[model samples]
Target: MFSGKLFLMFVATAMAQKDLSVDCGDDEWVTVRWRPELGFSQELDSSRALLGNCPPSRPASEDSLFFRVFLRDCGFIQQVTAGRVSYSNTLIYDPQPERAFISQPVQCVYDLSVGEEEPEETFSMEIMNPDFSGPAQSLRFRLGSSIPIRAVVEPRSRRPLRIYLESCEFATDANISRAAQVHPIIANAGCLMGSKAGNSSFLPRRRPDEMRLYLEAVWFAVGEQVFLHCVLEACAVQSLPVVRKACQFVPEHHRWVLLDDPSQSYACTCCDSSCLRTTDASVDGVSARKVLGPLVIVAEDPQGDASLDSQSSAGLSEAPVWLLVFAVVLVLMVCMSVLAVSYYLCFWRGGRLGYRPSRDLLTKY
Candidate 1:
């Protein structure tokens, strides 16, 4: 018997036929909950200070600490949020549920600071393609080929605020310490549009409110992790919390993101040789077919021997020896053929030497 608040809206956009009512799943919303006593308090803290931690450091500078926002495939995050939506979403109740609903996107914010007002926060999270996936999600990429890395950033600010796109794990700089220092990556606070789709007509940032990133993948990234970090350099909190010694009205609405783990990001694995994606199918569930990244596939041992991978490596090393032996045998055959030709032309055919074939069969030298 768990009950909380339910608020639904009707969203009609330029692309809508008339009016669209989204079935906001009772279980799907957004918040932070990992404890018993502090769970409620932490949720309140996150909701209250949604954009409060935007450090006052330079937006694209090396001094800023990237805030860690663990974003997974949209399906996974939506599923988890959906399940918890009905648990406890009743801070300020909405009076309208019978009215037409609107498309509700989870509020997104950037941690942008320009100076010493805010502390540097590491924003670590992975950007995996959407799919019905398990704990691990990885995109298969060839060694020399490239893959697109994109991220959708939606600001939680009420008004248009200046934010900066920082560094991603795919940065090419050899001396990069933070994820925001890469030059080729999108940066600055120019494409400032109200959190709406109709404001921009660009390809990457087609949705005005959302910005899509194109991170370049490198050959060395054959086996590594990828993460994206964005900072809200515009301002801290739209409604800064204070000592309400007297009275205060209900604050602005915001989404409390479930901070994700950096290690949970997809792990890249390079395939030097072609491998059959063999796995145990006896067990049930998604693990039967696919799994998270950092996947390991071992080659079958030859002759059904004990060693699997070690024997395969030893075989590669022994290839040169086999080649050397074949080369030596070929050289000996060529030398014997040359000797026979010379003997026939100079000794037997030219009348200098005579042939002895039957005598060799009867005698030993």
Candidate 2:
């Protein structure tokens, strides 16, 4: 009976150890997923293995264990397992500095034990040169982790000449879409330059002799969807002499600025107040008319145009003073003519009845 009890105890312990489970947190969490082949390589005081994965378990005093995090889309591998992960540390295959861009390989070393019941700890990784060149991308965390992380990438701000072409011509849906796609994309991506000038009261209102244009490209990435907003502006023109002097030496060529946002997962909104300007123009012999490019006005429905026409007709319903006067005069002239005809008929009937002028002739006969 004593032998049987000892055997039962051993079986229970084995079962409990085999029943390990790991919760990788939630869907919104960001994690680095690793492949089995690329194991971590760093010196660790204690081995901290992911709770429910292969490689079974590491020794308690192994100092360090190997683990790997593979970025499927970015084609990079990050080795993170239990040691100091700093920005100064270089990634094996990455040429850019650490933290320069998202999805780049990263390594983190932490002091923890594989036998620890709970695996919960916060780690900080510094990203150097956050501005990276590449297509827009995102990082999704694996399950069983806590602590949410949010990232936003803004384009480097620059002073560029921005011009907003406003006109009424882009009233159609097709036109608006075309203009939105063509004008902003091409112009914003094109080359341009700009400079800031101090405020001046006597600055010339006339057009400049030479203008430099700068283009800014904005990318709005909300989840899987992405949209672009482009801004074109003139730069290098300033009202202050000092600013002008400084700007004079800078190149007048166009520059492109790119921005990225990941929180907006579906639709992209480009609300740039700088691009709103009077779209009307008056050219030689022609009167000022609203210029509508290919872009349609998104603020109102197509039916609104008919409503505007109705309102215009309503405004014209009020007759002018001269028109009213002419109408009154016409009525008066018709009434006068009718009265004169009645008076003439009465006189003619009375003369016939009286027969006075013929009486002297009858007396002579």
lDDT of each: 0.26, 0.23
Kindly list the per-residue Cα lDDT of model 1 for residues 260-331, writing each as its tens digit.
211211110111121112212221110000112331112221223435555787885656677989999999
Report the C-alpha lDDT of model 2 over 1-365, residue by residue, as the tens digit.
Answer: 00010111111111222222111111111132222222266333222223111111334233323322111111111222343111111112111334221111232222223342221221121111113233213221112111111112111234222122111111112322222122222211111111111110011112422111221212112112122222212223343221111011112322112111112211111121111111111110001111211212222343566777877887747657798899999999999998777666657555343435567777887
Shift in Å, residue 302, candidate 1: 28
Q: What TM-score fits each model?
A: 0.25, 0.21
Error of 1 at 313 (Å): 2.2
Candidate achieving the largest TM-score: 1
After TM-score superposition, the amount by which residue 226's alpha carbon in candidate 2 deviates from its true location, in angstroms, is 18
* Residue 257 displacement (Å), model 1: 31
Candidate 2 achieves a global lDDT of 0.23
Residue runs of model 1 more than 4 Å from their true location after superposition = 1-147, 153-184, 190-211, 217-227, 232-335, 338-365
Model 2 CA RMSD to the hidden true structure, in angstroms: 25.2
lDDT score of model 1?
Answer: 0.26
